[model samples]
Target: MKAIVHVGLKPGVLDPQGKAVADTLGRMGYDEVHSARIGKVIELDLEGVAKDKADARVKEMCEKLLANTVIESYRYELVD
Candidate 1:
Protein backbone atom coordinates (compact mmCIF):
# COMPACT_ATOMS: atom_id res chain seq x y z
CA MET A 1 0.00 0.00 0.00
CA LYS A 2 0.97 3.61 -0.49
CA ALA A 3 0.15 6.53 1.70
CA ILE A 4 0.31 10.18 0.78
CA VAL A 5 0.47 12.72 3.54
CA HIS A 6 -0.08 16.44 3.31
CA VAL A 7 0.99 18.59 6.19
CA GLY A 8 0.34 22.30 6.49
CA LEU A 9 -0.17 25.13 8.88
CA LYS A 10 -3.68 25.81 9.98
CA PRO A 11 -5.56 28.87 8.79
CA GLY A 12 -4.77 32.05 10.77
CA VAL A 13 -1.16 30.90 11.17
CA LEU A 14 1.50 33.17 9.70
CA ASP A 15 3.29 31.61 6.75
CA PRO A 16 6.35 33.61 5.81
CA GLN A 17 7.46 31.21 3.10
CA GLY A 18 4.07 31.29 1.44
CA LYS A 19 4.01 35.06 1.70
CA ALA A 20 7.38 35.28 0.03
CA VAL A 21 6.23 33.07 -2.79
CA ALA A 22 3.16 35.21 -3.30
CA ASP A 23 5.21 38.34 -3.31
CA THR A 24 7.61 36.94 -5.87
CA LEU A 25 4.73 35.79 -8.04
CA GLY A 26 3.18 39.24 -7.88
CA ARG A 27 6.46 40.76 -8.94
CA MET A 28 6.56 38.28 -11.79
CA GLY A 29 3.10 39.47 -12.88
CA TYR A 30 0.91 36.81 -11.32
CA ASP A 31 -1.57 39.36 -10.11
CA GLU A 32 -4.42 36.95 -9.78
CA VAL A 33 -2.85 35.38 -6.71
CA HIS A 34 -4.28 37.02 -3.63
CA SER A 35 -2.72 34.62 -1.17
CA ALA A 36 -0.66 31.47 -1.02
CA ARG A 37 -0.13 28.73 1.52
CA ILE A 38 2.71 26.27 1.50
CA GLY A 39 2.64 22.67 2.60
CA LYS A 40 4.40 19.32 2.23
CA VAL A 41 3.54 16.10 0.46
CA ILE A 42 5.02 12.82 1.63
CA GLU A 43 4.58 9.48 -0.10
CA LEU A 44 5.34 6.19 1.58
CA ASP A 45 5.03 2.52 0.70
CA LEU A 46 4.25 -0.17 3.23
CA GLU A 47 3.33 -3.79 3.10
CA GLY A 48 0.91 -6.15 4.84
CA VAL A 49 -1.61 -3.70 6.17
CA ALA A 50 -5.36 -3.27 5.76
CA LYS A 51 -6.87 0.09 4.83
CA ASP A 52 -7.88 1.00 8.35
CA LYS A 53 -4.54 -0.06 9.78
CA ALA A 54 -2.70 1.83 7.10
CA ASP A 55 -4.69 4.95 7.82
CA ALA A 56 -3.88 4.72 11.51
CA ARG A 57 -0.21 4.11 10.88
CA VAL A 58 -0.01 7.01 8.49
CA LYS A 59 -1.76 9.26 10.97
CA GLU A 60 0.74 8.23 13.59
CA MET A 61 3.58 8.95 11.26
CA CYS A 62 2.20 12.41 10.67
CA GLU A 63 1.77 13.07 14.35
CA LYS A 64 5.20 11.78 15.25
CA LEU A 65 7.35 13.13 12.46
CA LEU A 66 5.50 14.41 9.42
CA ALA A 67 3.83 17.33 11.14
CA ASN A 68 4.41 19.65 14.05
CA THR A 69 1.11 19.45 15.84
CA VAL A 70 1.69 22.73 17.66
CA ILE A 71 1.34 24.77 14.47
CA GLU A 72 0.54 22.35 11.68
CA SER A 73 -2.23 19.91 10.81
CA TYR A 74 -2.18 16.93 8.48
CA ARG A 75 -4.38 14.72 6.33
CA TYR A 76 -3.54 11.49 4.54
CA GLU A 77 -4.93 9.11 1.98
CA LEU A 78 -4.21 5.56 0.98
CA VAL A 79 -3.42 4.44 -2.55
CA ASP A 80 -2.85 1.04 -4.01
Candidate 2:
Protein backbone atom coordinates (compact mmCIF):
# COMPACT_ATOMS: atom_id res chain seq x y z
CA MET A 1 0.00 0.00 0.00
CA LYS A 2 0.99 3.62 -0.48
CA ALA A 3 0.03 6.57 1.63
CA ILE A 4 -0.10 10.18 0.59
CA VAL A 5 -0.39 12.85 3.26
CA HIS A 6 -1.12 16.51 2.93
CA VAL A 7 -0.36 18.87 5.79
CA GLY A 8 -1.41 22.48 5.87
CA LEU A 9 -1.98 25.34 8.25
CA LYS A 10 -5.51 25.71 9.62
CA PRO A 11 -7.72 28.42 8.33
CA GLY A 12 -7.19 31.84 9.99
CA VAL A 13 -3.52 31.05 10.54
CA LEU A 14 -1.06 33.43 8.99
CA ASP A 15 1.09 32.15 6.13
CA PRO A 16 4.06 34.37 5.43
CA GLN A 17 5.43 32.24 2.64
CA GLY A 18 2.05 32.06 0.94
CA LYS A 19 1.66 35.79 1.23
CA ALA A 20 5.06 36.37 -0.29
CA VAL A 21 4.22 34.16 -3.23
CA ALA A 22 0.89 35.88 -3.77
CA ASP A 23 2.48 39.30 -3.61
CA THR A 24 5.15 38.29 -6.06
CA LEU A 25 2.57 36.87 -8.43
CA GLY A 26 0.56 40.05 -8.33
CA ARG A 27 3.63 42.09 -9.15
CA MET A 28 4.44 39.73 -11.98
CA GLY A 29 1.05 40.45 -13.58
CA TYR A 30 -0.92 37.49 -12.25
CA ASP A 31 -4.01 39.53 -11.54
CA GLU A 32 -6.21 36.47 -11.23
CA VAL A 33 -4.53 35.36 -8.05
CA HIS A 34 -5.97 37.09 -4.99
CA SER A 35 -4.34 35.08 -2.22
CA ALA A 36 -2.34 31.97 -1.61
CA ARG A 37 -1.73 29.29 0.99
CA ILE A 38 1.17 26.90 1.43
CA GLY A 39 1.12 23.23 2.36
CA LYS A 40 3.21 20.05 2.23
CA VAL A 41 2.84 16.56 0.80
CA ILE A 42 4.33 13.34 2.12
CA GLU A 43 4.31 10.01 0.30
CA LEU A 44 5.08 6.70 1.96
CA ASP A 45 5.21 3.09 0.86
CA LEU A 46 4.18 0.10 2.92
CA GLU A 47 5.21 -3.40 2.09
CA GLY A 48 2.87 -5.71 4.03
CA VAL A 49 0.16 -3.78 5.78
CA ALA A 50 -3.48 -4.25 4.89
CA LYS A 51 -5.46 -1.31 3.57
CA ASP A 52 -7.48 -0.87 6.76
CA LYS A 53 -4.41 -1.02 8.98
CA ALA A 54 -2.55 1.29 6.68
CA ASP A 55 -5.28 3.88 7.02
CA ALA A 56 -5.07 3.78 10.81
CA ARG A 57 -1.29 3.87 10.74
CA VAL A 58 -1.22 6.83 8.43
CA LYS A 59 -3.79 8.68 10.53
CA GLU A 60 -1.72 8.01 13.62
CA MET A 61 1.40 9.20 11.86
CA CYS A 62 -0.31 12.44 10.97
CA GLU A 63 -1.64 12.97 14.45
CA LYS A 64 1.62 12.14 16.17
CA LEU A 65 4.28 13.59 13.89
CA LEU A 66 3.11 14.56 10.44
CA ALA A 67 0.88 17.43 11.51
CA ASN A 68 0.97 19.98 14.30
CA THR A 69 -2.72 19.18 15.08
CA VAL A 70 -3.14 22.51 16.88
CA ILE A 71 -2.26 24.96 14.14
CA GLU A 72 -2.25 22.56 11.26
CA SER A 73 -4.66 20.04 9.72
CA TYR A 74 -3.98 16.98 7.61
CA ARG A 75 -5.64 14.58 5.21
CA TYR A 76 -4.38 11.41 3.57
CA GLU A 77 -5.10 8.94 0.79
CA LEU A 78 -4.26 5.29 0.40
CA VAL A 79 -3.42 3.61 -2.87
CA ASP A 80 -2.52 0.15 -3.96
Candidate 3:
Protein backbone atom coordinates (compact mmCIF):
# COMPACT_ATOMS: atom_id res chain seq x y z
CA MET A 1 0.00 0.00 0.00
CA LYS A 2 1.01 3.59 -0.51
CA ALA A 3 0.09 6.81 1.21
CA ILE A 4 0.49 10.35 -0.02
CA VAL A 5 0.46 13.16 2.51
CA HIS A 6 0.07 16.82 1.67
CA VAL A 7 0.84 19.44 4.29
CA GLY A 8 0.30 23.16 4.03
CA LEU A 9 -0.48 26.27 6.00
CA LYS A 10 -4.11 26.91 6.76
CA PRO A 11 -5.99 29.83 5.32
CA GLY A 12 -4.97 33.19 6.83
CA VAL A 13 -1.57 31.86 7.75
CA LEU A 14 1.48 33.83 6.56
CA ASP A 15 3.50 32.12 3.84
CA PRO A 16 6.71 33.88 2.91
CA GLN A 17 7.79 31.18 0.53
CA GLY A 18 4.48 31.40 -1.24
CA LYS A 19 4.85 35.12 -1.52
CA ALA A 20 8.27 34.77 -3.06
CA VAL A 21 7.02 32.26 -5.57
CA ALA A 22 4.16 34.53 -6.52
CA ASP A 23 6.53 37.43 -6.97
CA THR A 24 8.76 35.37 -9.20
CA LEU A 25 5.82 34.23 -11.24
CA GLY A 26 4.70 37.80 -11.75
CA ARG A 27 8.15 38.77 -12.91
CA MET A 28 8.08 35.86 -15.34
CA GLY A 29 4.89 37.25 -16.91
CA TYR A 30 2.37 35.09 -15.15
CA ASP A 31 0.12 38.03 -14.45
CA GLU A 32 -2.94 35.92 -13.76
CA VAL A 33 -1.31 34.21 -10.79
CA HIS A 34 -2.23 36.53 -7.97
CA SER A 35 -1.03 34.25 -5.24
CA ALA A 36 0.62 30.98 -4.45
CA ARG A 37 0.97 28.58 -1.55
CA ILE A 38 3.95 26.40 -0.79
CA GLY A 39 3.30 22.96 0.56
CA LYS A 40 4.85 19.54 1.04
CA VAL A 41 3.98 16.15 -0.36
CA ILE A 42 5.19 12.95 1.22
CA GLU A 43 4.81 9.47 -0.13
CA LEU A 44 5.16 6.33 1.93
CA ASP A 45 4.86 2.60 1.45
CA LEU A 46 3.42 0.26 4.06
CA GLU A 47 3.53 -3.48 4.39
CA GLY A 48 0.89 -5.94 5.54
CA VAL A 49 -1.84 -3.41 6.24
CA ALA A 50 -5.31 -2.91 4.86
CA LYS A 51 -6.09 0.37 3.13
CA ASP A 52 -8.27 1.63 5.99
CA LYS A 53 -5.67 0.72 8.59
CA ALA A 54 -2.91 2.30 6.52
CA ASP A 55 -4.92 5.48 6.18
CA ALA A 56 -5.31 5.72 9.93
CA ARG A 57 -1.66 5.04 10.51
CA VAL A 58 -0.65 7.64 7.95
CA LYS A 59 -2.88 10.21 9.63
CA GLU A 60 -1.25 9.38 12.92
CA MET A 61 2.16 9.81 11.33
CA CYS A 62 1.20 13.23 10.09
CA GLU A 63 -0.12 14.30 13.47
CA LYS A 64 2.82 12.93 15.40
CA LEU A 65 5.70 13.89 13.15
CA LEU A 66 4.97 14.99 9.56
CA ALA A 67 2.71 17.94 10.24
CA ASN A 68 2.58 20.82 12.68
CA THR A 69 -1.11 20.80 13.44
CA VAL A 70 -1.12 24.15 15.20
CA ILE A 71 -0.26 26.05 12.02
CA GLU A 72 -0.56 23.46 9.29
CA SER A 73 -3.31 21.25 7.87
CA TYR A 74 -2.81 17.93 6.14
CA ARG A 75 -4.77 15.61 3.83
CA TYR A 76 -3.83 12.15 2.69
CA GLU A 77 -4.63 9.65 -0.04
CA LEU A 78 -4.18 5.89 -0.10
CA VAL A 79 -2.99 4.16 -3.26
CA ASP A 80 -2.77 0.49 -4.04
Candidate 4:
Protein backbone atom coordinates (compact mmCIF):
# COMPACT_ATOMS: atom_id res chain seq x y z
CA MET A 1 0.00 0.00 0.00
CA LYS A 2 0.97 3.58 -0.63
CA ALA A 3 0.22 6.38 1.78
CA ILE A 4 0.56 10.13 1.37
CA VAL A 5 0.63 12.53 4.24
CA HIS A 6 0.10 16.25 3.96
CA VAL A 7 1.28 18.34 6.84
CA GLY A 8 0.51 22.02 7.26
CA LEU A 9 0.48 24.69 9.89
CA LYS A 10 -2.78 25.30 11.66
CA PRO A 11 -4.65 28.52 11.04
CA GLY A 12 -3.41 31.40 13.23
CA VAL A 13 0.04 29.81 13.49
CA LEU A 14 3.00 31.96 12.42
CA ASP A 15 4.77 30.84 9.25
CA PRO A 16 8.01 32.77 8.95
CA GLN A 17 9.30 30.79 5.99
CA GLY A 18 6.11 31.31 4.07
CA LYS A 19 6.17 35.01 4.83
CA ALA A 20 9.74 35.31 3.69
CA VAL A 21 8.98 33.64 0.39
CA ALA A 22 6.04 35.93 -0.17
CA ASP A 23 8.22 38.94 0.51
CA THR A 24 10.84 37.73 -1.96
CA LEU A 25 8.23 37.15 -4.62
CA GLY A 26 6.96 40.71 -4.26
CA ARG A 27 10.51 41.99 -4.49
CA MET A 28 10.89 40.02 -7.73
CA GLY A 29 7.81 41.80 -9.14
CA TYR A 30 5.39 39.05 -8.27
CA ASP A 31 3.27 41.59 -6.47
CA GLU A 32 0.30 39.46 -7.38
CA VAL A 33 1.56 36.87 -4.94
CA HIS A 34 -0.44 37.91 -1.93
CA SER A 35 -0.01 35.24 0.71
CA ALA A 36 1.82 31.95 0.87
CA ARG A 37 1.93 28.98 3.22
CA ILE A 38 4.61 26.32 3.42
CA GLY A 39 3.81 22.70 3.99
CA LYS A 40 5.25 19.23 3.43
CA VAL A 41 4.30 15.92 1.89
CA ILE A 42 5.36 12.48 3.14
CA GLU A 43 4.93 9.29 1.19
CA LEU A 44 5.11 5.83 2.73
CA ASP A 45 5.00 2.26 1.54
CA LEU A 46 3.62 -0.47 3.76
CA GLU A 47 2.95 -4.18 3.69
CA GLY A 48 0.71 -6.72 5.50
CA VAL A 49 -1.91 -4.15 6.39
CA ALA A 50 -5.45 -4.02 5.16
CA LYS A 51 -6.87 -0.74 3.88
CA ASP A 52 -8.88 -0.01 7.02
CA LYS A 53 -6.03 -0.93 9.34
CA ALA A 54 -3.60 1.09 7.29
CA ASP A 55 -5.75 4.19 7.59
CA ALA A 56 -5.95 3.87 11.35
CA ARG A 57 -2.23 3.21 11.71
CA VAL A 58 -1.32 6.12 9.48
CA LYS A 59 -3.50 8.44 11.50
CA GLU A 60 -1.73 7.31 14.65
CA MET A 61 1.64 7.90 13.04
CA CYS A 62 0.68 11.45 12.21
CA GLU A 63 -0.65 12.11 15.67
CA LYS A 64 2.36 10.67 17.43
CA LEU A 65 5.27 11.77 15.23
CA LEU A 66 4.34 12.98 11.78
CA ALA A 67 2.79 16.25 12.94
CA ASN A 68 2.95 18.57 15.90
CA THR A 69 -0.72 18.61 16.83
CA VAL A 70 -0.36 21.93 18.64
CA ILE A 71 0.73 23.94 15.60
CA GLU A 72 0.28 21.60 12.66
CA SER A 73 -2.48 19.56 11.11
CA TYR A 74 -2.12 16.42 9.05
CA ARG A 75 -4.23 14.22 6.81
CA TYR A 76 -3.34 11.09 4.92
CA GLU A 77 -4.59 9.02 2.05
CA LEU A 78 -4.13 5.34 1.35
CA VAL A 79 -3.73 4.19 -2.22
CA ASP A 80 -3.45 0.91 -3.95
Candidate 5:
Protein backbone atom coordinates (compact mmCIF):
# COMPACT_ATOMS: atom_id res chain seq x y z
CA MET A 1 0.00 0.00 0.00
CA LYS A 2 0.99 3.60 -0.53
CA ALA A 3 0.16 6.41 1.81
CA ILE A 4 0.22 10.09 0.97
CA VAL A 5 0.00 12.71 3.66
CA HIS A 6 -0.72 16.41 3.51
CA VAL A 7 0.29 18.43 6.52
CA GLY A 8 -0.63 22.04 7.18
CA LEU A 9 -1.13 24.61 9.86
CA LYS A 10 -4.46 24.64 11.63
CA PRO A 11 -6.78 27.60 11.76
CA GLY A 12 -6.02 30.35 14.33
CA VAL A 13 -2.29 29.57 14.16
CA LEU A 14 0.16 32.18 12.92
CA ASP A 15 2.07 31.22 9.78
CA PRO A 16 5.01 33.55 9.20
CA GLN A 17 6.17 31.74 6.11
CA GLY A 18 2.74 31.93 4.56
CA LYS A 19 2.43 35.56 5.47
CA ALA A 20 5.72 36.41 3.84
CA VAL A 21 4.71 34.74 0.62
CA ALA A 22 1.41 36.59 0.63
CA ASP A 23 3.12 39.90 1.16
CA THR A 24 5.49 39.25 -1.72
CA LEU A 25 2.67 38.36 -3.99
CA GLY A 26 0.80 41.53 -3.15
CA ARG A 27 3.79 43.68 -4.01
CA MET A 28 4.51 41.90 -7.29
CA GLY A 29 1.65 43.52 -9.20
CA TYR A 30 -0.66 40.84 -7.87
CA ASP A 31 -2.70 42.92 -5.49
CA GLU A 32 -5.74 40.77 -6.05
CA VAL A 33 -4.08 38.07 -3.99
CA HIS A 34 -5.31 38.09 -0.45
CA SER A 35 -3.33 35.34 1.29
CA ALA A 36 -1.09 32.35 0.80
CA ARG A 37 -0.62 29.23 2.86
CA ILE A 38 2.13 26.68 2.73
CA GLY A 39 1.95 22.98 3.34
CA LYS A 40 3.84 19.70 2.98
CA VAL A 41 3.33 16.36 1.32
CA ILE A 42 4.76 13.02 2.37
CA GLU A 43 4.51 9.71 0.54
CA LEU A 44 5.10 6.32 2.12
CA ASP A 45 5.33 2.89 0.59
CA LEU A 46 4.38 -0.08 2.71
CA GLU A 47 4.19 -3.78 2.11
CA GLY A 48 1.87 -6.49 3.51
CA VAL A 49 -0.60 -3.92 4.77
CA ALA A 50 -4.18 -4.19 3.64
CA LYS A 51 -5.99 -1.07 2.42
CA ASP A 52 -8.52 -1.51 5.19
CA LYS A 53 -5.78 -1.20 7.80
CA ALA A 54 -3.83 1.62 6.19
CA ASP A 55 -5.94 4.52 7.43
CA ALA A 56 -5.44 3.77 11.07
CA ARG A 57 -1.76 3.13 10.66
CA VAL A 58 -1.31 6.26 8.61
CA LYS A 59 -3.23 8.34 11.13
CA GLU A 60 -1.06 6.93 13.88
CA MET A 61 2.03 7.83 11.92
CA CYS A 62 0.79 11.42 11.55
CA GLU A 63 -0.12 11.81 15.18
CA LYS A 64 3.07 10.22 16.44
CA LEU A 65 5.72 11.57 14.11
CA LEU A 66 4.60 12.82 10.71
CA ALA A 67 2.77 15.93 11.88
CA ASN A 68 2.98 18.35 14.78
CA THR A 69 -0.50 17.86 16.15
CA VAL A 70 -0.12 20.89 18.40
CA ILE A 71 -0.14 23.44 15.55
CA GLU A 72 -0.84 21.40 12.45
CA SER A 73 -3.38 19.00 11.00
CA TYR A 74 -2.90 16.16 8.55
CA ARG A 75 -4.89 14.08 6.09
CA TYR A 76 -3.87 10.90 4.33
CA GLU A 77 -4.91 8.87 1.30
CA LEU A 78 -4.09 5.22 0.74
CA VAL A 79 -3.56 3.57 -2.62
CA ASP A 80 -2.93 0.00 -3.48
Candidate 6:
Protein backbone atom coordinates (compact mmCIF):
# COMPACT_ATOMS: atom_id res chain seq x y z
CA MET A 1 0.00 0.00 0.00
CA LYS A 2 1.07 3.57 -0.60
CA ALA A 3 0.18 6.68 1.33
CA ILE A 4 0.34 10.10 -0.26
CA VAL A 5 0.35 12.96 2.20
CA HIS A 6 -0.21 16.61 1.42
CA VAL A 7 0.94 19.05 4.07
CA GLY A 8 0.65 22.82 4.06
CA LEU A 9 0.47 25.86 6.26
CA LYS A 10 -2.90 26.73 7.75
CA PRO A 11 -4.81 29.58 6.15
CA GLY A 12 -3.84 32.12 8.78
CA VAL A 13 -0.18 31.18 8.70
CA LEU A 14 2.44 33.14 6.78
CA ASP A 15 4.09 31.53 3.76
CA PRO A 16 7.23 33.36 2.69
CA GLN A 17 8.14 30.83 0.03
CA GLY A 18 4.72 31.10 -1.57
CA LYS A 19 4.84 34.86 -1.46
CA ALA A 20 8.23 34.88 -3.13
CA VAL A 21 6.97 32.64 -5.90
CA ALA A 22 3.98 34.87 -6.44
CA ASP A 23 6.15 37.98 -6.60
CA THR A 24 8.47 36.28 -9.08
CA LEU A 25 5.55 35.21 -11.21
CA GLY A 26 4.13 38.73 -11.34
CA ARG A 27 7.52 40.14 -12.27
CA MET A 28 7.80 37.51 -15.02
CA GLY A 29 4.52 38.66 -16.63
CA TYR A 30 2.20 36.16 -14.95
CA ASP A 31 -0.24 38.87 -13.94
CA GLU A 32 -3.01 36.34 -13.64
CA VAL A 33 -1.41 34.84 -10.55
CA HIS A 34 -2.37 36.89 -7.53
CA SER A 35 -1.06 34.55 -4.91
CA ALA A 36 0.44 31.15 -4.25
CA ARG A 37 0.85 28.70 -1.38
CA ILE A 38 3.74 26.34 -0.79
CA GLY A 39 3.18 22.81 0.39
CA LYS A 40 4.81 19.41 0.62
CA VAL A 41 3.91 15.94 -0.58
CA ILE A 42 5.09 12.83 1.20
CA GLU A 43 4.81 9.30 -0.14
CA LEU A 44 5.11 6.31 2.13
CA ASP A 45 5.08 2.64 1.25
CA LEU A 46 3.57 0.18 3.70
CA GLU A 47 3.69 -3.57 3.71
CA GLY A 48 1.31 -4.84 6.38
CA VAL A 49 -1.34 -2.23 7.10
CA ALA A 50 -4.94 -3.38 6.74
CA LYS A 51 -7.30 -1.22 4.70
CA ASP A 52 -9.50 -0.38 7.65
CA LYS A 53 -6.56 0.67 9.81
CA ALA A 54 -4.71 2.60 7.17
CA ASP A 55 -6.55 5.85 7.75
CA ALA A 56 -5.98 5.89 11.48
CA ARG A 57 -2.34 4.93 11.14
CA VAL A 58 -1.64 7.58 8.57
CA LYS A 59 -3.45 10.20 10.60
CA GLU A 60 -1.32 9.30 13.57
CA MET A 61 1.80 9.60 11.52
CA CYS A 62 0.84 13.09 10.43
CA GLU A 63 -0.12 14.23 13.88
CA LYS A 64 3.01 12.80 15.43
CA LEU A 65 5.72 13.75 12.97
CA LEU A 66 4.65 14.38 9.39
CA ALA A 67 3.01 17.74 10.08
CA ASN A 68 3.41 20.55 12.55
CA THR A 69 -0.25 20.45 13.62
CA VAL A 70 -0.01 23.85 15.37
CA ILE A 71 0.40 25.72 12.07
CA GLU A 72 0.10 23.07 9.39
CA SER A 73 -2.75 20.93 8.11
CA TYR A 74 -2.52 17.62 6.33
CA ARG A 75 -4.60 15.21 4.25
CA TYR A 76 -3.69 11.83 2.88
CA GLU A 77 -4.81 9.23 0.37
CA LEU A 78 -4.10 5.53 0.48
CA VAL A 79 -3.71 3.33 -2.57
CA ASP A 80 -2.88 -0.25 -3.20
Q: What lDDT tens digits, residue by residue, belong to model 2 across residues 1-80?
A: 78999999999999999999999999999999999999999999889988998899899999999999999999999989
Q: Could you give candidate 1's per-residue lDDT for residues 44-80 as a string of tens digits?
A: 9889999998888888899899999999999988999
Per-model lDDT: 0.92, 0.95, 0.93, 0.96, 0.92, 0.96
lDDT of 2 at 1: 79
State the TM-score for model 3: 0.88
Q: Which tens-of-lDDT digit does each residue in 1-80 have in candidate 5?
A: 78999999999899999999999998898998899889999999989888878888899999999999999999999977
Worst 10 residues of 5 by lDDT: 48-57
What is the alpha-carbon lDDT of model 1 when measured against the actual structure? 0.92
Model 3 global lDDT (CA atoms, 0 to 1): 0.93
Error of 3 at 9 (Å): 0.8
**Best TM-score among the predictions, by candidate number:** 4
lDDT of 5: 0.92
lDDT of 6 by residue, 1-80 (tens): 99999999999899999999999999999999999999999999988879779889999999999999999999999989
- Candidate 2 wrong stretches, greater than 4 Å: none
lDDT of 5 at 60: 93
Candidate 1 off by > 4 Å? none
Better of 1 and 3 by lDDT: 3
Quote the lDDT for 45 in model 4: 94
Question: lDDT tens digits, residues 1-80, model 3?
Answer: 88889999999999999999999999999999999999999988888998888878898999999999999999999989
Which one wins by lDDT: 1 or 2? 2
Off by over 4 Å in 5: none
